[model samples]
Target chain A: MSKVALLLGSLRRPGNGIGIASWLHPVLREGLNDTSSGTAHTGVDVVFVDPTKPPLPLGPIVDGSHVPADIRDPSKHPNPNVREFATFVTSCNGIVVLSPEYNRGYPGELKNTFDHLYWEWHKKPVLLVTYGSSGGANCSALLRSFLGGPLKMQVAEKAVAIKLPKSHSNGSDKAPTQGPAPDWLEQYRPEVLAAVAEFKDLISQQSSS
Target chain B: MSKVALLLGSLRRPGNGIGIASWLHPVLREGLNDTSSGTAHTGVDVVFVDPTKPPLPLGPIVDGSHVPADIRDPSKHPNPNVREFATFVTSCNGIVVLSPEYNRGYPGELKNTFDHLYWEWHKKPVLLVTYGSSGGANCSALLRSFLGGPLKMQVAEKAVAIKLPKSHSNGSDKAPTQGPAPDWLEQYRPEVLAAVAEFKDLISQQSSS
Candidate 1:
């Protein structure tokens, strides 16, 4: 089965980034097969890589390379999360980063996870879905540069940036809450669909080749 | 006494960021008074805010605002480190962030400390000294926007980006190592001095006013 890692990049529990992703998860899952004309997406499963659930450590390597070089592969790494995470990353066909612009850029927690990780992202297509004060425009540019330049990932040309108006926001990017999809999801559904359509096409190409 | 908080923003103990700060500390301390033409800087003390030393938490409020609102003042916060840290931030004349660029951005541990902070950085003059493969330019721009935007801080006109050559870097920003200064210190001393001169003048004005 083809898999896409939906990365939640907000440090906050109920952050708008998570909220948007929460709303879009089902749509993406159901919509993957909805495309009648585009590249055939077969079993394109959308999986979440939420930072808070197990909470990826603040640093790249948990023990900072205390593990012997021989044992540093995916299975034997000292940290269970990193071990599992590396394997999970390689198993995926594509990625979707749902992030919030903290300050003027993306959250460090998100960037921290990708540090020291070189090959896991190789040739994988990425779709950035950002939410913040500036609709996450500034963050989108920086993340694109970093991911494409060093991580060697292919970022989809189309992306979504949801600028939550101050009046509507409850403020914090909280952990995923249980409820119906957030209200704003309907407004941006079309843009997200476009981005995901582009994303799936890229993923389809990667899988075949 | 004019105090400047020299922030070591790298997670690695002997990281390049710490190395540069260590080399620059004594120079900045002694040279703060070396100025003859610019604003008078007296007793300019350069203090190190090394993340690994005490290791600021991976967050702003240690309890994440678990404490009641009334006791949230700098003096009464539940977390001793944060209480003291907030007070320390307020006591400073200016701030110097000595950071290494990680994947085109600043470290999250450093940014996490300032997440909900508002008053501490108000009108504070900040000089960013960045070290990275890109000579720290990309990280510099993102940080400048963040500090100048939500944090309400002033980014100094003169900043330094020391791009350590890959051949020279031991491949990581390790914690500040013991012993004689690293060899590259001498090469960058003059540029370092110029940046500090501008930094000290800003501090001097902030102190005098």
Candidate 2:
């Protein structure tokens, strides 16, 4: 089974990140469970990583000292959170980042998390999932540049963008209670499933090679 | 006299943002005073705006509600910070942004401040000044898009970048006590002065036209 990490980029209680994640999580699970068609496949394992509960203090990362001589060397790093996060990333076969577009870019918190670990992210396949009024096109572009340029991660071509409606209430204090997926989101369900399948295939191919 | 606002994008103590700002501020002042070059120029008034001491709470801006019915109308907005910042932006004949590169992009706080007001930024000529390992090329590109796209601000072609040395120490607690500019920074001094002159010329043309 290929392990996939779903990194949520926002911390707001009723933010669009949670709302989209709530919908994406189930759809992804259903995709993993479906094995009746075509070749038999191992189901995927999914884990959620939230940027709000940062694994390590962002000072070192922001100051550009988070990377050491040997990225996997625990002795060089004292932060347990960084070690744990590094372990999680290295173990994962692929990653899916769900981020809200903030001022035409991804949250700094999310970038901080990525900056904390360097070599652990190299060669891992990543899928970008963004939500916003402009469908997060700009933030997704920026994220792709960072992933491809600095991190050297294998970024998937097919990404998912959930465009929130103009009237969508964001930043409300209430936790997003599970409800029927909106029609707008329902239309994008197939695309999300396709992205998951592609991610799985890419990871499997990389593992075998 | 033309009023120019200098927006500092970094909050880190003894960071590159302050270092570049200190250099640019005086250069800009000298440019404003030097009218003997050719055309008799009006004296320039420079004001420093730090994102660390934000005039308003960032909630409304992050949620994308900072745009008022009439972007120039302060009566429609309830946030006092927005109104105060709006006044500052509108009063300025031009703006100069000095930002430090963080994670291959501009700081979130700087983006948050821009999101807080809309029309106040329209048509205002802007010059980008960035400093970092890669001379903040990526952050400057992103900032240009922001200035040209949503804010509808006029961006100058001439920009200044102060490339920090690899051995430079950032985030030091020691106050950036006045000292001679480092050798690397000294090389970029002429470039900074040229950018300031270009910015003054752009703003002057905009005012007359």
Candidate 3:
């Protein structure tokens, strides 16, 4: 049984990032549940780490009252939040990241989260579900480079991108009634699933070895 | 009169990004103030675009919020703050961008700002001053690619990058500060001055053309 953690990176609650993830979670759950093993993917646990959460007072950084010493070189910094996040990632077999496209890149909170803990991210299997004007493709691509190069993470090549062109608004939709997701997403779902499955298998094999 | 806008991207006021910019402003002012050649980069103006201003009305997609219609494409979506920023950038002759690196990438707000405006940014001359853990080198490269591909901006090849390692917080009497800048920025004065001068030339040429 492998456990995967889904990290949602965005300040807005009903953002496209979370909305699309909401839609995908059921599919992933159903896929894992229907597996031949008969056992469900209960192992797949998700914890949404919101950046706006109030911090525990370890020092100045957490309180936002003053600059934290750990921020200077976050990779080596020893902060409680960083430790907690790293522990969660290290415990999980895989990760699913959902983030918005800010400016031309990933949101600051996401970067701040990762910056504080680099070692935990090494060699982890991660998938990105990104959305925005350009489907956040540039942001995802830039993020992939950063993770692959410095953080040393094995980022899945097939990212799930929800560009605005495809989004249709439905009054019932969790996302701003944004219309339906694009047809390509449905068409390519199998590929993305297969990739995740393979990645899980690889992680399991490594664990056994 | 060429009006050059310095769009400060970082949220930290007294942080490295603004401090570096402040140090270089005098040099630019000197060049702009030169009386002999009225063409010495006059009509200088600096405006700091705050990233935390407010949410934009993202047209129909954003529901009640005021997102501009042109932000349909993710690549075209300016930062949420850009709805106001576009007006300033379009009216200016050139732009000097001050950015900080987070997790080996541009701060989310900085990227968000660019995501909002589309056509207003085309053909603008951008002088990059990126500072971070490793002097923001990787971020600088990624930014160049982004601006070149989508924004269609003339990104100056010569950028001023201040590696965090080189920063000097304490001024020693033995080693007096050399450049026109204050003591803290003595280490990075050369690159800083060079970038500003180069930016002045780029803007002057573009404004005349």
True contacts kept of each: 0.23, 0.09, 0.21
TM-scores of the models, in the order given: 0.85, 0.76, 0.69
**Per-residue lDDT of candidate 1, residues B1-209 (tens digit):** 77888887775533455567777788667667675736667777888886655535435222432322234366665656766777888888888887777666776666666654556777898988888666778778877888888777878887888878664353434434457765555576777778777877777677667
Report lDDT (CA) for all predictions: 0.69, 0.70, 0.58
Error of 3 at A38 (Å): 14
| Top-scoring candidate (DockQ) | 1
Candidate 2 off by > 4 Å: A1-3, A10-15, A33-45, A49-93, A102-109, A163-177, A204-209, B1-3, B12-15, B37-45, B54-91, B102-104, B169-177, B205-209
Global Cα lDDT for candidate 3: 0.58
How accurate locally is residue B51 in candidate 2, as Cα lDDT from 0 to 100? 57
Candidate order by TM-score, decreasing, is 1, 2, 3
DockQ for every model comes to 0.34, 0.19, 0.23
From the highest lDDT down, the ranking of the candidates is 2, 1, 3
- Name the 10 consecutive residues with the lowest summed lDDT in model 1 chain B: B60-69
